[model samples]
Target: MTILVSGKNGQLGHCLVDRLNFSDLDYISLDKKEMDITKYDETARIIGEIKPRVIINTAAYTDVEKSEIDKKDAILANESGPENLSKICKKIDTPLIHISTDYVFDGRSEIPYKPEDDVNPKSFYGMSKLAGEQRIQENCDSYMIIRTSWLFSEYGKNFLKTMLKISKQKKTIDVICDQIGCPTYAGHLADAILKPIKKISENNFDSGIYHYAGDQECSWFEFTNEIFFVANNLGYIEKIPNLNKILAKDFQAKAKRPNYSVLDSSKFCKAFGVNPSNWKESLPDVIKSAVLA
Candidate 1:
């Protein structure tokens, strides 16, 4: 059976491709240039020709701040794109594995969010992603929506790389401490995603929303501190920058982020027999790659 992975240029897409390369799985990974999901004709044509048994959609407009002003682009990529893919998957009788965000929640809850928790997105980017999730559920009979948080990887632009890059140039930096969430490693998330794909291919698929993220939860400040400490020990960085913790309100961002958006992956762990991503354990590899790049 073949798997079609969208967003080959993305962090998650790159990690997915890395895993797929090591495996014996037959798959095709595409970026927007090759398959613009917002274009129904193009998406349908590509998927129809490939005829993949499973479709993993990692393509999304991820800029939270830009989404507020670029509503058209955000909706086209995050909402319309998923809507198109869902319809195509439904028509072709292919199962869809979609990646979602923790931003779907308003971040009012103190406890980690479950798959069945109420969703009230506070940002346009989150709203767009939520719209995509709803579309997939409405249009596709066989689909798994995995809601992940604070994704970082060796590939692409992400928090881990940003921290590493800025630390080298700046003596100090300020990070918001008010917001709290898990920092998931894309490599681990890619592996978590594949476990379900195997189940789906084996006809033991259980469809619905599932939360998968790092096992440890921390504020952005704490995450940054850990990154610096890890990178320093790994000799990737010569010095650790002074990290200042500030409230979210003090930060000038166009988007309103959740104060708390930690996800509960117990459901996913029980179903897939996989543990939540150990982001700290995988930090060394990510740091090494970022430093080398």
Candidate 2:
């Protein structure tokens, strides 16, 4: 059976491509340059030709700040693109595995977000993604929506890389401590994505929204501290910098982030039978490959 993966250039997509390479399954990954997901006719034609049994859609407009100004493009990618894909998937009777974000919540909850919780997205990016989820629920019968948070990996631009670069340049840096969430390694998430692929084929899994993230949670400041810690161990940097804690507002970000966005992924573990990876344990490899190398 063939699986089609969209957004090949993204961090998750890159990791997914790598993970799928070691597998026996036949899969094809596409980036926007190859396939504009917003163009329904073209996407439909491409999928028709491939005739994939499963579609894993990681495609999204992820720029939180840019989405505020570029609502049209963001909405198109996050909302309309998924809907169009879902419609085709529904018609062909192929199951869809869609990647969503923790941004769908406003970040006010003291505890982790459950799938059934009332959603209140504060940003356009969050709203658009939530819209995509709603659209998929409405249009597709067979689907899995996996919501993740603070994703980082060796591939693509992410916080880990930013911290590594900044740490090397500056002896001291400030990181936001107010915003809290788990830093999901894309490689771990890629593995999680595959855990259910076989189950999907066996028809043992049901269509529903699930959360998957790193095992532990922390603020962005703590996450950065861990990055420097790993980086120092990996010998990427001679010394770790002093990281001063600051509030989210102190950081120059256009988008408002949730104060607490840690996702409760117990449901995913219950459903997929795979436990979440510990971010600290997973960081060494990422630091070696991306930061040190």
What C-alpha lDDT values do all the predictions have? Answer: 0.93, 0.90
Candidate RMSDs in order? 0.8, 1.2
Off by over 4 Å in 1: none
Lowest lDDT block of 10, candidate 2 = 195-204
Candidate 1 lDDT tens digits, 1-293: 99999999999999999999999899999999999999999889999999999999999999899999999999999999999999999898888999999999999999999999999999999999999999999999889999999999988889999988899799989999999999999999999999778777555777899999999999999999899999999888888888888999999999999999999999999998999999999998888887787
Per-prediction TM-score: 0.98, 0.97
The sequence of per-residue lDDT tens digits that candidate 2 reaches over residues 30-121 is 99988788999999999999998899999999999999999999999999999999999988888999999999999889999998888999
lDDT of 1 at 13: 98
Error of 2 at 29 (Å): 1.2
Best by lDDT: 1
Instruction: For candidate 1, give the lDDT of residue 155.
Output: 88
